[model samples]
Target chain A: MEEAKEGFEPKIIGFTCNWCTYAGADLAGTSRKKYPPNIRIIRLMCSGRLDPMFVLKVLLNGADGVFIGGCHPGECHYIKGNFYARRRIAALRTILKQFGLDDRVRSEWISASEGDKFARVMKEMAEDIKKLGPNPMRDKIL
Target chain B: MKGTELKQEDLEGLFKGLLDKKAVDCLVLPHKVGNNVAYMLVKDGDKIESPAASAIFAPSFGVNAANIVKGWTIPERVGIVAKPCEIRAAIELIKLKQMDKESVLLISADCSGAFTNQDYADHAGEIGDWVDSAKINELKGKGIAIREACAICENRLADVGDIIIERVDGGKVLVAGITDMGDEALSSTELSLEDKDVERQAEKEKIAADAKKEKEELPKMSSVEELEEFLRDCIACKNCRDMCPVCYCKECFFEQPLGKPVGGDLLNLAELRSAIGVPTNQLLYHLTRIYHVCTTCVGCGACEDACPKDIPLTRLYPLIAKKVQEIFEYVPGEDAEEPLPFITYEEEELEDKLR
Candidate 1:
């Protein structure tokens, strides 16, 4: 592992659900919450729409971290969308462990009212990614 | 319940009895037609001969037989003899509602393993009227091997069959009635049966365990680069999807115009990304298919068998599917009555799968 260069900022991609996590991030902004701006948030209508390939593509393309945010279980706006997403995430995590990038991926349930929690999570994730240094995939020759 | 002990040569007699007693109006079995052995629909008991018996114990169009049975909805019961994997496949198709179960009598035979069609021809110069297990084993061990899928097969004993013919001590075979339908079918014949449980289970488990360990130790493609390189030889012929028994979609999602890009779409996609692969969605195609078949795939290795490029699709798709199956604690085709993993959901299930 290499040390993070001075003033080095990690690039993180977050797939957030429009109904919950997206609003939570919005709330965090209005609340004057301070958090790392490393993540480039991609808003989807439902967390279930976050295909496993999206995470895989970003990770393979050298994204330092890939975070997925959705509604809590049984509280999905689409009734059962979050449940399906949960299953897919579990399978993906197990698969990524074998790829040596399981630590690079994480998912959480953030309600719209949990602005403080959202800001805290982003800060924590950004720090974790910084310590992890640049994604090794960025240096691959393939 | 007890079972009848019979000579290996008496399988043909059993089939004849099933047909003669009207247990089944039509019997679907593997028969030698000219040079190629295939599963044929036989109505006449007289036509059930030596080749059918040999082909039953040996692998002969068994998976395809499952697919064939899946399409048929007959009023008269048809007796179909398939190997363990083939029987499991049929049970899956039935669960998918593609096949009607009441119209067919599922018969399974304990299989040591069988060679592929081409391998049998190349290796066994003469597959005589009597297909001997000792001879097959000798050929299987010498240079030429069984099909990769067959070699690593976990379930060679028919676990879902109503009637089973298994190997016993001293070159004898046990033809037993496992279910009510099986016992009734057995009672129709003059062949005496003792309702004893079949042996060879321990042996089958050992073989399966050894195969599973070997498969686990095989090199797997983890990174996207490795997967792309692993599938580099693929010409996108889709012979794998076509031959897969679990892939029963009448209009495949990939085959629709959506997956194939038109001229403008191709140019736009390429321009957006600066550059793109010519045959787009090659990776997407494989991933979507493996995901779709994760719950239903029986690991029969039919896809690899059908691959013209020899992509080792079983190694790629079914292995991942097997992992997914484990996460759900769902074994495809283990029980026909059990619902598919994807369609059914538990409220608090997959708790560990999510954050």
Candidate 2:
């Protein structure tokens, strides 16, 4: 973890839905395609299951950026779950800003077969969050 | 109208008449108990009494009653006796697809006042199976019957009810229809409703002015620690959760099988710092609940009334909810078709990025 945290190296916590984004991530590994090492993935059944506090908790726990990838619209195994997740992420982004931690939070839609796009999105998000620097909550780390 | 007093018999007879005549399935009405008002279910408008013991209030009651009717094959048409706040809550719930208004009816009445749970207990001394409105009105002219939230509330007349049973004069009440269903329902009732346009206008104006003032004074904690201190006794009793109308999850995440309890039981510093399986983080629990139900919070103040520890959760939830809506422009329960705040986005949903 320390080696991965060298100067200007962003620690991105990615919450990917198992049905789509998670599968896409797995396929990326199987295909021998390399992506940024800074991205750490936690697979959830549905993006709708991701709670707003979980984002805050991750940021407060020291991640420089938090990325949420879910199934494309109307493609969720749990129909309309991605739609709900979309609204939740939009609301979460606003709350993050109120706490002055908005730049580090990002959300997008990805399908099960978009491994190449997933890699590119992660790389782009990591570069954007790197410009924002380390999370402020890191100072309070006990 | 002056305070002449409303009897239990009067309300019961009025509501029963509505149900007997196929006017409504249920009435979302408040019953007076020991000087406090409680919103409860009036089955077919019979056995009319205060549902103070039923901690859930209007906004939740509307959706709950709607769900109950939907489940039962009978009562294809149901009615909800609600307050203004409940009507607003029902609107949000309807928008969220949590409720179906097709089989439901709304019979809203003027809410004059009510009492907090603590105040009701203090007043209901010794003789207590449950108190009703007649005894409460007996203390009239002495200022003994008033809820803290009600006293501050300006939205006395509900704008959303199909039929509004308003206290018009000292000697009579007006059962008027604000909607087409209300008009049809009222047309069926034998009670006469004249066009009292002036009286209705005055009452509505007074309420609007009062609501403006009330909105200005919405309660909010100055800091994060202040909120933490206010919610100190939450302890995950789930009273607020149960009372809330919009928290409709069959099983909450906090109550999940894998979700272990955290905090409480250890005394040592190391154990205290690292206590596992303790139901701690009251703030996290509340924040999650607020996020889940923010769009649907109707500000009915039921959660605070139901809390055994008197956490003032009603005030806090609404405060946070207002902030969420302001930041996101997403009002829960307003329009069923409008996407939920967290579910959809606009071109400039992140307009604040510029700020």
lDDT of 1 by residue, B243-350 (tens): 888888888876776666778877876676666665666766786677667778777777887888878776776677778888889877776779877566777876
The reply for model 1, stretches above 4 Å from the true place, is A1-19, A38-66, A77-79, A92-105, A123-142, B1-3, B20-22, B33-36, B59-63, B71-78, B126-141, B179-194, B347-351
What's the TM-score of each model vs. the native?
A: 0.84, 0.65
Residue-by-residue lDDT tens digits, candidate 2, B216-272: 665655443455568767777887877676666678776763233433322342253
**Model 2 spans > 4 angstroms off:** A1-11, A16-64, A69-86, A95-104, A107-142, B1-13, B25-28, B38-78, B91-102, B112-114, B120-156, B167-172, B192-227, B260-277, B326-355
Consecutive 10-residue window with the lowest summed lDDT within model 1 chain A: A133-142
Candidate 2 docking class: incorrect
Residue B36 displacement (Å), model 1 = 5.3
Candidates' DockQ values?
Answer: 0.33, 0.15
Write down the TM-score for model 2: 0.65
